[model samples]
Target: MAAIPTSNASLKDALLRPGFTPTSPAATRLSDPIADTPLVLTLDDVLPYDANPRTTQNPKYDEIKESIRQRGLDAPPPVTRRPGEEKYRIRNGGNTRLSILKELYQETGDDRYYRFHCLFRPWDAARGEIIVLTGHLAENDLKGDLKFIERAIAVEKARTLYEAEAGKAVSQRELASRLSADGYPVSQSHISKMLDTIQHLLPAIPGLLYSGLGVDRISKILALRKTASACWDKHYQGEGVEFEMLFQDVLSQFEGDAEEFFFDRFQDELVGQMKKPLALGYEDVLLEITQQQRELRRSMPIVDAPSLPAPPAAAPAPDTSLPDDTAPGDAPPQQPPELPEPPARLAQQTGSQVQLPVTPPAGDQMSDEERQARIDGHVVSPANISPRVVETKRKVAAALGETLPDFNSNALIAIPVQAGSLHPISDLWYIEHDIDTPEHLREHIAQLAFEITQSVNAPGEIIPVDGGIGFSYKQPADEVDITETAHHTLTLLQSLSGATAIALKMLGEQPAPAAMDALGEFQFAAGLGQILLGQPTARDQAPDDSGRLSDGALVKLFRIVRLARRLIDLEIQEYATNTSELNG
Candidate 1:
């Protein structure tokens, strides 16, 4: 409640005032009052805590106690009596100091500090009296109180102390314990609510109240805080005011000219509410709006249809204004010829209902590679009930320029269902291609076959694309040398990369038609090249041989095979290595 004094005076000068002076109890002698040793009080007296939020705990209490024990009590705690109680209570300073005395007493069992007293020193000169009220001391001081933010911080400090000392989740009781520990002069619930207010309510208000309001006031606001007090109550660009707008306006008058500074700082509470549109606990409001909209539609008035014009002008009055047709014969003008019932097998899986679009993703938003990835890696199980998958397939059919027959309800069952979300790289994904030549078509077909089998089948266990059915471990990818073909294709691609003249050398060795498979031919030529380089050294080499894949000619055939089955290109290898290095 105090500010800078109009008149400047040193603290010592102010201490000279009549009621602000120091005094001593005449019960004991001053010179050797302690009888040589200091006294330590016990819990039988008081506990420790911070009296006000403005003041912090004196961490050096132990040292100060030690100093006092070594010398003497320099200052006594200020105390005041509770208004209507015989026991004394501390008003300004906290009981933390008393608790320190108690600790000292329990440790050393000395009561020297309490035993000492002054003998008739001054008539009315007392530094600060230890007036006990309701059994506690009052420690009112001339120094001004703390700011609002300062108090909030102190409240948090007290809360931390309570939690630490109790070693548990703190409650109001813990607040009380902290008050005793930190020398505070407060009630249990008061301290508890003060701490909670800062955390939950203050943050929601933006910078609205940070202009140094009173801690007690802010604490009250936070404790009384409700979701209704924040931004959701804003007029939303004045488009429409919520019912709470008037209440907020009324409250703003109480906050005064906090907005006078930044204006926004004061209105920050409102602005934050607007910028961050929030309505605490979503379910309630959402349901309310839906209910209202339903009610509105129900309240709409019904209207009758206008009379139909006479059909005589166009042709003849349709049936001469007869009632609507009950059968085709009655509406003979509009009737069409009927057809025979559809066959049972033809009714299995096709329908108009299949046209719904599900998994709505923008076609243009995703890149071609991403879209293709979905087609390539995704899975569609028969069990899946993809509400709009039929529509997706129809679109795909259009894209491929394929004919689509009139759908029959039974035909819908034939389509695959949603097994899970599309990963876009699964083995069963649909195939897409721009077919040009027979060679190209053949290559795509071979690649797809190899990819599907490789993806689903391992050397041992295999999961069939069909929910069941696959080859055993001993079987070779449908009785063909799939591994050898794959390796051959890899090597052929490698040979193509080198000089064109070197490629001609391969042609001279074997004709395209003669090669069982171009891919296999490429692998053979590449393996032969490796043996000549001695790149894959055989375990034991013969110095000479006829060279029909003999010890001398073969030259570590397994190693050559691995090299020929190359998956990564030179450029790709470099890129991968660089990326790995960066990640590491």
Candidate 2:
């Protein structure tokens, strides 16, 4: 062909970023100089050579052949140096183009519209093959180095490629498998680089590699980003930190410190997550995440603000005319006006004679229907009320129909285990509450809590999740001032829920409990509240001898002898009482 005006250019013709042109000669120049276009081949000549012995029998070949049959090949495939020849190589380029063309032709039925490019090498070298293939690797794909992170990724990639080429058995499949196994997914280029590493990257930073400047522009860290990040471009490992932990520590610092966020954020965030795949070193990271999520979702209930005594369930917004009871009636010892106080709180409200629904948790904002359901209590109550409670319950039953609504708040109670088990000191439970409800739910919740725990009970209510009436044994430190949120907490303690009472009882023992002061805010703050929250397990008990208990420790001294005498006398009294009862 005559010296074409556009003699040299990128064969693939992929989209170029700003300041780049597809047909520019720079796009196709070879890195190493050795080339021969497989002895005068064209798109049509690609399939017949069958020279790529490795993939000649590849199943994809049939698909390629079919493509070529339907539409002319679009672009040229890549190539490489022959076994020992300085030229006349057929690594991959031209064939790849033909395959693409074949596929496109079959896909669109118009092969002429298809296009492709070639990485033709110098008649004597494979430099062109190297240069062009390097373009396949975009810089956005690798993890940062322990130090000089960017360079580290590039160097590692280069080393992997070199190793694969040195090993004749290496393949793209192998490279992909290796990366995936390492928790870093391998891709086409990733695999290819591992196999041949034909592509290369020039120093992206001006003096980063030499001047010891920062590896500012990180690239190609896609899958590896989550494992860890380097600061000052240096990755470090603490005494016990894992590959992921190192990155997470720095990431934690960057959360509030991040001015410009990055995609690698997700990896850092999940690393050392507190709950699942639990990592103790990163517990603080998990707590921070919880706080952040709370802020972001607007789900945290505010507890500090002063709120008014929420009026009792409004008496259906007062009917038009006053009832006969309010009007002049045959007076015989006039009764007092009904107050909307909780049967317990009736004395608290003064001068207000409003009719209030006996709806518990009336202070909380709830829909009319929900209030009715809660007051009605039973989702499905007995139709036959035995006439006793007809006057008081018939109206509610009629209004609620078959919808038997239980308390809204979920109760979680922990049943303490026996010694040598998970718990030994006490048979009581730990618990947590999810929804707001009245005190009436206490006994019921406690009973349910007992049944669910398998500690003791007769057919108790089963909670939704596996754990029973969930209590927050994981409370604040003993010194933490929990009184601020006591009100909300107190409302929870209405003596109605055993779960709430037990939770409070445990907290109350501490100086400042988990009690909220009126609103859900902490009335008194402390540095040590949460510390006391975590329960002590049986293992924490002071063992008699690293758990080697001996009778000598308990019964060898004079004090033990006195206790022994007392025990014998007690037994004698118990025997006398039994004997008298038997005689009677």
Candidate 3:
């Protein structure tokens, strides 16, 4: 509601001419007087602090931009005013808002939208870094809108800024706790993984961060960060391979500019490679190319011989005289020698494995240690793994019966899901608080049992491919894994269907422990059925990998045979109880 001055002189005059109100009795003891009254100025006077550690991308960005354009600012920008400068630097927050405002101003020439209202705070060079860093971190964390990469970047920046301010390195846990105190509740383990993704995986593939990929996409790849790094170290040995070359190679494999699509394809291929019993995966492929390069480098001489050499020349005499061929003012005439052209760069070798292009110019190469440092930063410390990673690993180990040595579980599940292969259980969640009749439930259970039985007997034959056999199931390769356990589970489910049907029939007439026992078996059966349908395959080999149903599907022939059995039991029990009461 308050209007402010447009310039330094008028700002001073306005501050002096203010009708000030005394602070309320409720004011906290720690409250800073300077933070009480926010500063108001034209948006032109507020400059974005380029070093503020936060970023957001769209269509998420587009959403925020549209929201502000329609609804205006919900929170004012936070800025720092210099000692004698007229302008204020937005230390943290409101960057997206500022961008939107500027855009709207340009589009519509609206003056009202051109003004900025912000909290004006004092700045100290050293401490200001911490303040600004923490401010943006808290703001983004509270909004819960930062993509995985953005959060990683912000977290890394916070650690760097804090260490710079305090003059000592802080442990990740300590930093996370500090951030938590400042209003962003985050765990040390999470910070550690985020650091790894931002510091390592992203640097290894520079353009990926900018290619419309989000945090979810980045985090999925970071699951294989260690394996990829090991592969990189094994093949390239030194940081001779440019990240751009690798990114370009990946980009070339897919059509269109939709980065997520490319990423999905890339991760799929990488996963398939990882699944190979003898494959070195992404690294092995890259390493072959490196070997070929070494061969070519060895064949070529370091320095080429001159095409022609000049004849031996005698020393010039002490000369005050000009050459007889030249006049006094004539330009000194000399013929220029033809210089030989440099040899052409080596053409990349053609193969299935991704080939690293010829080594880029010297300036573009990163040193081995520098590249390793980036990766090391993102590697999840075995000493402090996050709960999510731990749980994912546990589930994966149980399901697959093999330990993924350095792999993160979150990535194992996430990559397949993002690729549209595995679906979350939440997708099939239903709210069935009550049911009506036992006979009605029995009919439903019978129908489900018939469908599941038919599927179990249906031929799920495998077709032979170049290397291994691929399944002939109608489902896409992304939907299911062809594990032996899944095959057994389907068979067991078929047998259990008879017991479930009997239980449903018994419940409609009279309730008994036999019916209850049959019903109870439904839970175990359904759980396994879901796992069989939802689980990701060990290898990304075949095209029809996705099973007919998602992990969370209900009332489906392939995915939820057991769920149907359970629902029938629930209705039967309810009917039996009601009938008993009426007889009493």
Q: Of the candidates shown, which would achieve the greatest TM-score relative to the real structure? A: 3
Worst 10 residues of 1 by lDDT: 340-349
- The sequence of per-residue lDDT tens digits that candidate 1 reaches over residues 187-243 is 554554556556554444424455545443453343223333433443234445453
lDDT of 2: 0.33
Provide the overall lDDT of each model, using Cα atoms, as 2-decimal numbers.
0.37, 0.33, 0.49
| Number of the top lDDT candidate | 3
Q: TM-score of every model?
A: 0.21, 0.22, 0.43
User: What's the residue-level lDDT of 391 in candidate 3?
Assistant: 75
Question: Where does the lowest 10-residue lDDT sum fall in candidate 2?
Answer: 410-419
Tell me the tens digit of each residue's lDDT in model 2 across 328-386.
12233233465221121111211211221222333244333233323223111113333
**What lDDT does candidate 2 reach at residue 128?**
31
Tell me the deviation in Å of residue 127 in model 2: 5.2
- lDDT-best of 1 and 2: 1
Q: lDDT, candidate 2, residue 302?
A: 21
Distance from true location, Cα of 571 in model 1, Å = 99
